[model samples]
Target: MSPDLRVIVYPPDAQGGRRVRVDGEILGRALGPNDLFEFLRQAAQDADDVCLDDGLLIEWRGGGPALGSPDAA
Candidate 1:
């Protein structure tokens, strides 16, 4: 993961599902632990943060410098 590029994994919902959203847009959905990890991994590649249900907040710490800017540098 890049320094400035953080990855967040929110807690699962009541039904045990997670969502990958950015700026109020739905990107994907993960329905299990494995799927959630995979989602987080993929999101990490782009250094993006994800929220499970637009509430919980979980993020990866101690990353290197961002490969690019958030606006696509």
Candidate 2:
């Protein structure tokens, strides 16, 4: 994952799937980190080299990883 790439994981939807966007382009919906990784991989990103915890790489909106609901407090 390039440091310049802006990755955003949106809030979880009713089915607990989150929308993933890379560089302003919506890749797809991810249900977990593995799904997100696959999406990144398909986007030509170094998924294995990318750290999901790195805020510089991923900007988790509404909730962070481990959050499974949009209503999560």
Candidate 3:
């Protein structure tokens, strides 16, 4: 993982949306949960793990998206 690259997602707002932060910078309004993956992909980010607001962990391995770590419960 690149030290300059980190994703931070804030808890849901009144409309059940989240604000995504890439390296401590925000784009505009909050984004839907489904858009997270698309954002990362468009940004060319190849992450081993994606940490959500509720602590749900999504991982990318071998260029595919998975819900969680393969070694965890």
Candidate 4:
């Protein structure tokens, strides 16, 4: 967690898909098609648990192509 961390949220795309991006990096891309609702709920919980003063919580919503290899990011 960095003091200068930033959060950005991108709304789901036409296909109701979401991603998670932190700062300028893509954390994960393309959540499960059948689990979008559960995903969002869990994401909200996870984001809420994060200490805002510590780092940042970012959520990117959309069905666009995932940025990079999710595991290495």
Candidate 5:
């Protein structure tokens, strides 16, 4: 990913789905890594080049890659 590229994974909603944004444009909701990968793949066509664990490339809010409601029992 380019140094100028910015990907933000917003906090999960009540259903445990997160909104994905690339460079400020909202792509869609992702329920897991595959969902997020597809979004990035379509947006940049270089999903293989991205690393979910790379903090500099992706900004994960509320939680990391784990999928679940923060308040879920």
Candidate 6:
């Protein structure tokens, strides 16, 4: 099986903590405890690429879809 690219956040001094959101939403926190494999599997199915706050990027296979023409900023 191929390797999955993703990051899992472990709580500090706590169990069943929040999971960080992959999208570009700062000050946002994930709700509920989740399994790493399951979360990445689902995210990979939807979005082709995922970015983290710490300058870490996890891209899916096939490089995902290409962006459209450069329209606006």
Q: Which residue runs of candidate 2 sit more than 4 Å off their true CA positions?
A: 69-73
> What C-alpha lDDT, on a 0 to 100 scale, does residue 51 get in candidate 4?
39
Candidate 3 regions exceeding 4 Å error are 1-4, 28-32, 46-73
Off by over 4 Å in 6: 1-10, 16-18, 25-34, 45-73
lDDT of each: 0.40, 0.84, 0.46, 0.39, 0.82, 0.32
Under the 3 Å rule for N, CA and C atoms, how many clashes does model 6 have?
0
Q: What lDDT tens digits, residue by residue, belong to model 3 across residues 1-73?
A: 3445666655555554555566656643334434675566555665344443323332222222222223222
lDDT of 1 by residue, 7-72 (tens): 343445565445545334455655543454465565554214434232234341222112111221
Stretches off by above 4 angstroms in model 4 are 1-3, 30-48, 51-73
The best-first sequence of candidates by TM-score reads 2, 5, 3, 1, 4, 6
Q: Per-residue lDDT of 1-73 in model 2, one digit per residue for the tens?
A: 6777889999889899999998889999988888888889987898779887778889999878779734332
Per-residue lDDT tens digits for candidate 4, residues 16-72, read 344545556544544342232234344444433443222234333331223221321
Candidate achieving higher lDDT, 2 or 4: 2
Clashes of each: 2, 0, 0, 2, 0, 0
Q: Which model scores highest in TM-score? A: 2
Location of the lowest summed lDDT over 10 successive residues in candidate 2: 64-73
- All candidates: TM-score: 0.36, 0.86, 0.50, 0.35, 0.85, 0.28
Tell me how candidate 4 scores on lDDT. Answer: 0.39
- Off-target runs (Cα >4 Å) in candidate 1 are 21-26, 40-73
**1 or 4, which is superior by TM-score?**
1
Off by over 4 Å in 5: 69-73
Best by lDDT: 2
- What's the best-to-worst order under lDDT? 2, 5, 3, 1, 4, 6
Residue lDDT tens for model 5, 1-73: 7788789999989889999999889999888888888998878658778888789999999977774533322
